[model samples]
Target: MVLSVHEKVKSERLYKAFDLMAAKDLDAAETELHAGLSDAEAQEDKVLAALFYSSLGVLYKIKKEFPKAWKFYEKAEKLLPEDPALKLISARLLIDVFGQFDTAIRRCQKVLEISRSDPPFLHQANVTMGLALLKKGERTKAVSCLVDAMQDDFEGLLSASNIDLKLVEALLRKRSGLEECRAYLEKALRFAESKQEERHVELFRRLIEAFPTEEATDVKIQM
Candidate 1:
């Protein structure tokens, strides 16, 4: 496809934003990303615009502005109807930004239906689907999704939020399999504690404190 003047401008601005991110100047990155979004809209570059929105959502998430992140993610999802890449990225950002587990699940489900064993984004879709299901308390379903994601052999795809296959294992182990879960959570707790990610550490701690060991086994998912 031929690139329009506005699209070119937007693309350049987007590049600048990524450069800023690479330099660890998050604020500057956000400024450049916003500029790119503006140009993309002006040019009516729907695909590029959707991508920029998703990028904005990720930036906002790193900045801890969850609501703002969700706003941009929703925009991306709305704008990118024809592109599976755009849809999948938007969906993953929805989970990272808003913690809207159900919405993330739905998006992952849609991608599973459409993705034809492609590279890159297909792997991402699997990881996002797994995490979404996990967050929604669907232990069995979550394990299935994540296990499917693991088929891609991509590790860094979903590492930004300290969630990965290990986290999934810990969560499932704690709920479904007693000895296995305890061991997993203990390992996860060590990692979280060492990283000083107190919030995450507290989450695991709460599981230990709130429920009896026997009760942890055979726990039904709420959602």
Candidate 2:
């Protein structure tokens, strides 16, 4: 249908913009997004407009234009007030880049309240909340949130190499639970094996190797 075609075009445009952004062709990326935004406005398609706005936010964030990014993100949020995805992304930026831990936690709580039915959303929300709590010196509650995040999408988390890599490092550094971290990496290795992802397999292998093994003194012989 016409709508599907429009969506496809919009999606392709968005991807192309992001690809350019990744390549550091900032001007071209901005041009692409702006053109798409104009088209969305011409169509009176607020959803697509919001999509471009959010993308602009990401682009500006990459350019280290925090205020511009925040403006675009807020514009998108206003257009789609109940959007948990926007909250998730904005929360991440607020906490990691802006160091607005309290605001990020508030946004994460909103995501938890609204995105319970979506496991990925809930999982990310929990992880973000955990990170925010950790920043606020609440380790116990942070660990609890991280545990909930792990439970929410263990398989999905394991499958994502970069995400899982950073998360595993964080867990190890924070000592969220060393046993759990090792076990998680073990499962990630298995997932890599199943998918025949050689890079992931090797990465997980090295990570698991980096973990300290059981000490000989901890073992006792039975008479």
Candidate 3:
């Protein structure tokens, strides 16, 4: 399982690029990514090249350079057409950057179809699909997808995110059971508390306040 020198160099560059990107040093990040891409190309490793391209796509997307992001994603997809993770990224970009909900939902569905054994990817695909459906005015289906995502999230990671809040809001708007909506909001509240997300904490607090005493009491907050 030892990596060749080229793979080692490529991996190091990619990791550095990711760190730089996290620090908001976009120019340095882009340079490191390009260096990785060059090494990957020199090695004739399509998988490595695809990975670098996908990273570049995300970097450009974060910078709001949609065209460049799309171009890099397209290149990545061409190299790894069956990659579920890349497909999920492309779907997210389509929904968030390109406003292509239908296309994004289709891409997510495709990923879900192929990524049955990968629960983390499945959760992400479902969340992306739910978001796309929500944007498409299909609240009922959106709620279904979001619920599926939350149910699949055995680690509770996804349930602690704003996606849970989105689910609660959707259910409330649909006049779902008071206890059901409270349950989601409570999960969100715990997540906010854990992350020290004050805004989300306040939001959940306000939503919980709207519920009756019995329903609020029924919603248990996890420590």
Cα RMSDs of all predictions? 12.7, 9.6, 9.9
Taking the tens digit of each residue's C-alpha lDDT, what string does model 3 give over 90-140?
Answer: 576566545768978988899889877766667677778877887788877
TM-score of each: 0.44, 0.56, 0.49
Prediction 3 TM-score vs. true: 0.49
Given candidate 3, what's the lDDT at residue 167?
Answer: 39
- TM accuracy, model 2: 0.56
Candidate 2's C-alpha lDDT? 0.68
Question: In candidate 2, what are the lDDT values of residues 50-77, reduced to their tens digit?
Answer: 7789778878987899999999988888
- Higher-scoring candidate on TM-score, 1 or 3: 3
User: Which runs in model 2 stand beyond 4 Å of their true positions?
Assistant: 1-76, 152-158, 194-196, 212-223
> Each candidate: what lDDT?
0.61, 0.68, 0.69
Best by lDDT: 3
Model 3 bad stretches (over 4 Å): 1-75, 152-181, 185-223
Output the worst ten-in-a-row residue range by lDDT, candidate 2: 1-10
What's the CA RMSD of model 2 in angstroms?
Answer: 9.6
- How does residue 132 of candidate 2 score in lDDT? 79
